[model samples]
Target chain A: MELDLSVEIAGLKLKNPVMNASGTYDPLRYESLVDPNLLGAVVLKSLTLNPREGNPPPRIVEVACGIVNSIGIQNEGVEEFIKVKVPLLRKFKEATFIASVAGLTPNEFAEVVEALEGVDIFKAYEINTSCPNLEKGGVNCALDERCIQQVTKAVRGKTNKPVIVKLAPDVTDIVAIAKVAVDAGADALTIANTYRALVVDLKSRKPILHNVTGGLSGPAIKPITLRLVYEVVKALDVPVIASGGITSANDALEYLLVGAKAVQIGTMNFVRHDIMIKIIEGIKKFMVDEGIKDIKEFIGTLRT
Target chain B: MKLVECSVTHNLRVRPEYHILGLECGELGSIEPGQFITVSVDSVEMVLRRPFSIYRVFENRGVIEIFFKVVGKGTKALSELKEGMAVSVLGPLGKGFPLYEGVTAVLLSRGVGLASLALLGDKLKGLKSRVVTIASFKGRDADLASDNEYVKSFSDEVIVLYDEDRSSDVENVRYLLNKVKPDVVYTCGSKRLVRLLKELPYEAYVAWEERMGCAVGACRSCAVRTVAGYKLTCYDGPVFNVRDLIL
Candidate 1:
C-alpha cells in the first residue's frame, strides 16, 4: 500500500514532517550534499533587524549525547537577507523556505515580518523568541507573558502569512506561555528551542564557551523535549512543531506519536549531511510496515 | 563536498600523542592545500565528528592522510581503529589556502598547526614558488619536528624552533619576517601567534581552529570575530586573510 507523508500546518503543505531546525541546517551549504526537495522544508538561520557579528571563539562543545552552542544569531541583516539571500534561495524551487526572525523588541519583530511580506519564497515566519544564546531579545522575551503576547500580536498584524512562535523549554509552566501565544494570534508553535546550559572545562577550571553559556541540543535532550511537546500539544489547540536532538526517523516518529505535526532536525546535521534523506526513507518504511496509509493517523496517537 | 566511506589503511603513532591516519578513498576528488576532512568517530558517546587538516593526499594511490593529536575522546577513539575498518569522512571542506604562484611564500606554524600547512608547502613548491617553512614546538616535544619528513620534502628550507631556546622566540618571527620580506605569508597556530601575525603588514592568511558544532556554516558555532563582522571558521574559512580578521 502507498503511504502518504504529506502534512499541512497553518495552510502550508509539507511533503513530509521532517525539516531542519532553524540555525542548525543551512540549505545553501549542503546543496551539493543532499537534495533539499527530499525534506518538508528548510529553515534559514535566524535573522535580526541588523547584521550581527555573533559571539567570539569556543562557540560550541560536545557533551555525552549532544552539543552546546553560543552562536548568538550571527547573520547578515534583514535587508541583505531580502536583497541577497532570498534570490539565492529562489533557485531551490522544490523546497519550502521558512524565514526565522529574531528581534530585540515587538516593533523589531513586526519590522522583520513587514520586510519579508513581499518575498514570495518564504512560506512561513518562525519568530525565534526562545533562543537562549542572545544577549537581548532571546529567551528573556519568551519567559514573560506580556513579551510573548506583544511579539506575537505585533508580527500577526504585519503578515498574512503563517506565524509560528518558537518557545524555549526553560520556563516553569510551558502551557501558560502557549496559552498566551495562541490567544495573541500565533498560527502554530515550534514546541521548545534548545535548553539553556553550561559546560565547565575540567582542565582549565573555566567555562568552555566564550559566551559562558549556550543552548543545548541533541539526543540527550530528546526525552525532556519530548515530554514538553506531549504536555504542550495536549494543552494547546494549534499544531506543534517539535525540535530538539532529533537525529533519526524513529526520533521523529516519537514526536509525531506525541502530537508534533512536524519534527526539526538539529545538532545531528553536523553528524551527517544526508540525515534528512535517511529520515524521510525511514519514516516511509515505518509507515508501510505498520499498514498506515496517512501519516496524520499517527499524530498524537500516544496512549496513556 | 561528498561523504565517502574510506577504509583506514594505516594508523601510525609517530609520537606518544600524535598519529598519522591514512584512509584509502576511491577516486578522491580534488582536495586543495589547507582544506580539511571531518572524520566521524565510531563511538556513540562522542557526538561530534573530529575535523582534521589534510596532511597529505596521494591522489594517484587513492589515499589521503590526516595528522591529529589524541587530545580528547573522539580522536582517541579514532586512533584505536585498525586497518581495513570503514570510516565515514566529509571533505575536502572549507576554503583552503589560496594558490600563490611565482611568488616567494613564508609559512609559519606551531605544534599540530603544521598538520594544516604540511600539504600547503607541497602545493607552493609545486607552483615553483620559493617556500620557507618555520615550525615551533614546546621544548621536550622537539622530536615531533623530525617525525614529519613530508615537511622537509617540499620546502626550500625548514626551520624548527623550540620554546626552551630563548633566541628562537616571537622576536625571531619578526627577524625572519624582515629577513624573508616575502610576497605572501601563510600561518596557522595558537591565537597568540595569530595576534602577532595580525600586526604584520604582509599579505597573510591564517587557518583558524575553533570548537565546531557543524563543520559546515549552518550552526555558526565556529565564528571568528573580524573587522568586517563575524565569520564562520568552518565556512568563511578554516583560512582567512590576516587583514580581514580582528585577531
Candidate 2:
C-alpha cells in the first residue's frame, strides 16, 4: 500500500512529520545538502525584538552522549529576519517556514508576532518562552502559568496564525503550564525545550559555559524527554510537537506513538547535516514494513 | 559545501598525540588552504562534528586528508577509525586564507596548528617571486619529523622553536618578525600569536579554532566576538584578517 506521511496541526499542513528544531538548522545553509522542499516546515532561529550578539564564548561543551549550549539565542531580530532573510527565504516557494519568537516580556512577544504578521511566507509561529522574563526575575522556563498565559494571549491577540508554545521539561508541573497555555489560546505545544544542565572544567574549577548553566540536547536526553512528552500528550487535548532530542525516525515514531503531532530534529543535525533525509526515508521504510497506509493511523497508537 | 559519506582510505598516526585521517572525496577537491571540514566522529555518544583544516586534497586520487591531534573524545574516536570505515564528512566549509601574487609571506603556527598553513604555503610558493618563510612553534614533545618535512617542501626557509628553549618566546618571535619583515603573515589557532600579529606593522591573518556545532551558521555556537557584533568561527571563518578580530 502507498503510505501517506503528511500531517496537519492547528490548520497548518505538513507534507511529512520531519522538521529541524528552531536554532538547530538553517535552510539557507543546509538547502544545498538537505532540500527545504522535502521538509515539513523550515523552522528558523529564535528572533527577538532587536539584534542580539548572544553570549560570550565558550558557549558549548560536548559531554558524554550530548552537548550543552548557552548560545543566548543570537539572532538578527524580527526586522532583519523580515528584511534580510525573508527576501532570500522567499525563493523557496514550496517550503513552509515557521518563525520562532522570543522576548523578555509578554508585550515584547506580541510585538514580534505583530512584526512578522505581514510576512507572507511564514506558515506559523513557534514561541520560545525560555527567555528570562523581566517580571519573573529568572528564565521563564516556560512554566509560569501567569507568564505563559500572558505571553500566549498577547501573541494570540496579534495574529490569526498558529501559536506554538515551546515549554521547558525541567519544571515540576508541565501539564499545568501546558493547560494554561492552551486556555490562553496556544494552538499547540512543543512539549519540551532543552533540559537545563551544567558542565564543569576540573582544572579551572569553573563552569564551561559562559552563562554557567545551559540547555542540554542530544541522544542522552531522548528517553527522559520521551517520558515527559508521554505525560503531556496524555493530559492535553491540544497538539504537541515533540522537540527534545529526536535523532532518528525511530525516535520520531516513538513520539508519534505517544501522540505528538510532529517531531523536531535538534542536536543531531550538527552531527550529520543530511540526517533529516535519512530519517524521512527511514520513516517511509518503517511504514512500508508495518503495512501502515497513512501516518495519522499510526500516530497515538502506543500499545500499552 | 555538501555532505559526503566516504570510507576512510587511511588513518595514519603520526604519533601518539597526532593522526592524519584520509577519506575518499569523489570529484570534490576544489578547496584552498586554511578552509576546514567538519568530520562527524560518527558516534552516537558524540553530539557535534570535529572541524579540521584541509591539510591536503588530491582531486585526481579522490582523497581528502585531515591532520588532527587527540585532545578529546572526538579526536580519540577519530584516531581509532580504520580503513574502509564509513564516515560523514561535511565541507570544505568556512573561508580560507586570502592569497595575493608576488607577495612575501610568513607561515607562523603552533603545534598541530601547522597543518592549517601548509596548503597555503604551497600555494604561496607557486606565485612569481613570492618568498615563503615558516616559523613553527612546538612544545617539548610536539616536535615531529613529518611536520618539519611537510612545511619544508614549499617554504623557502624553516625556523623551528620549542618550549625546551625560550627561542619561541614573544620577544624572540617579535625579533624574527622584524628580521623577515614579510609583506603579509599567516598564523594558526593561537590567541597570543594573533594578538601579537595585530600589533605588528605587516598585514596578518589567523586560522581560528573553535568549539563548533552545526558547522553551518545555524546554531551560532562557535561565535568569534568582533568589533562588529559576532561572527561564526565555523561559517564566517576558520581564517580571518587579524584586524577584524577582537582577540
Candidate 3:
C-alpha cells in the first residue's frame, strides 16, 4: 500500500506535512548536512525592515526537557534577504520557501511584503506576530486582537501570496486571536510560538541569559502547544500549521490528528541535522503499518 | 563537518575539577587551530551536546584531545565516561583562527579559555613564528598546565598569572606585550579580560564563548554582537577579530 504524504496548506502544495520553524533551522547552514529538498517547506529566519544585531551573549540555556533562547531574530533584514539569501534558497527547487517577516508596525510589515512582491522563489509569507524574545513588536502584536488583524490585513493587501499568521501561546484566549486573524484574511495559522520563560542560575543567583527572558521550546512545551493547536483549529476555518516541540513523526502525527494541516520542526534540529529524514521515513512507515493510504484520513481525525 | 563516533582512549582527571579527554578518531580531516567539536553524552537527562575546543590534535596518532571542566550537568556526565566508550562527535565545526606565518604572536588564555588557544600556540610554532603564551588561572590549584606537557613544548615562553594576585597581573601582561610588541595577539577569557585585551594597540583576535544550540549554526542561538551585526559564533566564528566585535 502506498501512503500519500502530501499536504496542501493555504494555496501552496507541500510534498509532506513537515516543515521548519523560523529562526530554528537555517537552510544555508545545514544545506550540506541535510538535503533541504527533502523537507516539505523551509521557513527562513524572521527578517525585519533593517538588519538587527540581536541580543547580547548567553542567548540560550537548556532546562529540564526544553531550551530557553533570546536570539531576538537576528537577521540581515529584508533587502539583504532578497539579494543574498533568496538566491541561495532558490537552488532548493523541491522545497517550498516560506519567508518569515517581522516588523515593528503594520506599515513596515506591508513594506516587507511589497519588497518581496514578484520574487518567484517564495511560495508564501509567514507573518511572525508572536516571537516572545524580541524587545518590542513581536509578542505585543499577537496579544492584542486588533494588532493581529492589522498586521495580517496589511500583509494580505501587499501580496497575493498566501499569508500564515504565527500566533503566540502567551495569550489568554488564543482562539479569539485565531478568529481575528482568519477574519482579517489570514490564509493559514501557525498555532503557538515559544512561551515566554526565564531560567535562574543557582550559583550566580541571577538569570542565565543576558537578556533575562527568552522563549522556551522543546518537549516541555509540546502538551501546552498541542492543546492550543486543538482549540485554535476547532475555532477557525483557516488551515492550522502546528509548531512546538515536534521532534518525531509520532509528535507530528498527534498535531495532524488534532486538526493541524502541517507541522514545523524547531528545537530538535539542534539534536541532529538529519532528523527530518528520520521523521519523514518514520511517518511513511507509520502510515504503512496503520493501513492508511492518505495522510488526510488521519488529519483532524482525533476522536472527540 | 561530519558526525563520527570515536572511541575514548583516555579520560584523565588532571585537576580536581578538570578532565582531559582523548579520543582515537581516524583522520578528522583538516581541523583548523581554533575549531571546536560538539560532544554528545548518551544520557537521557542531557539533551544538548556540549561544545569543547580542540585542545590538541595528534594527526599521526589519530587522536583528538579536549579539555573540559566539570562545571554543570553536561560536563559532569561526560566526566564519568571510561576507555573504549563510543562518544558521538560533530566536529571541525566553526571558523578557526587565521594563521600568519613568520609573524610574532601573543596568546593570552584565562581559565578554561586556554583550551581554545593551546593548539594555536603549537600551530604558530610550526609556522616558525614567535609565540608567547600567558596562562592565567583563578589560583595555583586551578592550573592544569603542570599536568599537560604540550603547552610547554608549543610556546617559546609560558607566563603563569594568578587572579588571587590581581594588582600586578594586568601590569605583567602589559610588560610582556611591551617586550614582545608582536604583530598580532589572540585571547580567550571572560568578558572583562576580552574587554581589556581590546584596549591593546596591536591587532587581536578573540575566541568567544556562548551557550550554543546546533553548534553548526543551524540554530541562531550562539550570536555575538559585533560592530557590523550579529555574528553566529558557531559559524561566522568562535574566533573573531577583536576590532570587529563590540565587546
**How would you encode candidate 1's per-residue C-alpha lDDT over A1-304 as one tens digit per residue?**
8789999999999999999899878888888787887789998888888988788878898989888888777888899988888888888889999999888787888898888899998999999985432435354787888888988999999988999999988899999999899999999999889898999988899999988988888889999999999899888789999998787889999999999999998888889888988899999999999989999999999999
- Stretches of candidate 3 above 4 Å error? A131-139, A202-205, B42-45, B165-168
Worst 10 residues of 1 chain A by lDDT: A130-139
Clashing pairs in 2: none
Query: Can you rank all candidates by DockQ, best first?
Result: 2, 1, 3
Interface RMSD of structure candidate 1 (Å): 1.3
Q: Against the correct fold, how does model 3 do in TM-score?
A: 0.93
Determine which window of 10 residues in candidate 3 chain B has minimal summed lDDT. Answer: B40-49
Model 1 alpha-carbon drift over 4 Å, by segment: A131-139, B140-142
Which candidate do you rate higher for DockQ, 2 or 3?
A: 2
Model 3 Cα lDDT, one tens digit per residue, B148-179: 58888878788788878872277777777888
Better of 1 and 2 by DockQ: 2
lDDT by residue for model 1 (B77-192), tens: 98899999999999888999999888889888888888899899899889999988878788656445655678878888887788887545888888887798888888887766
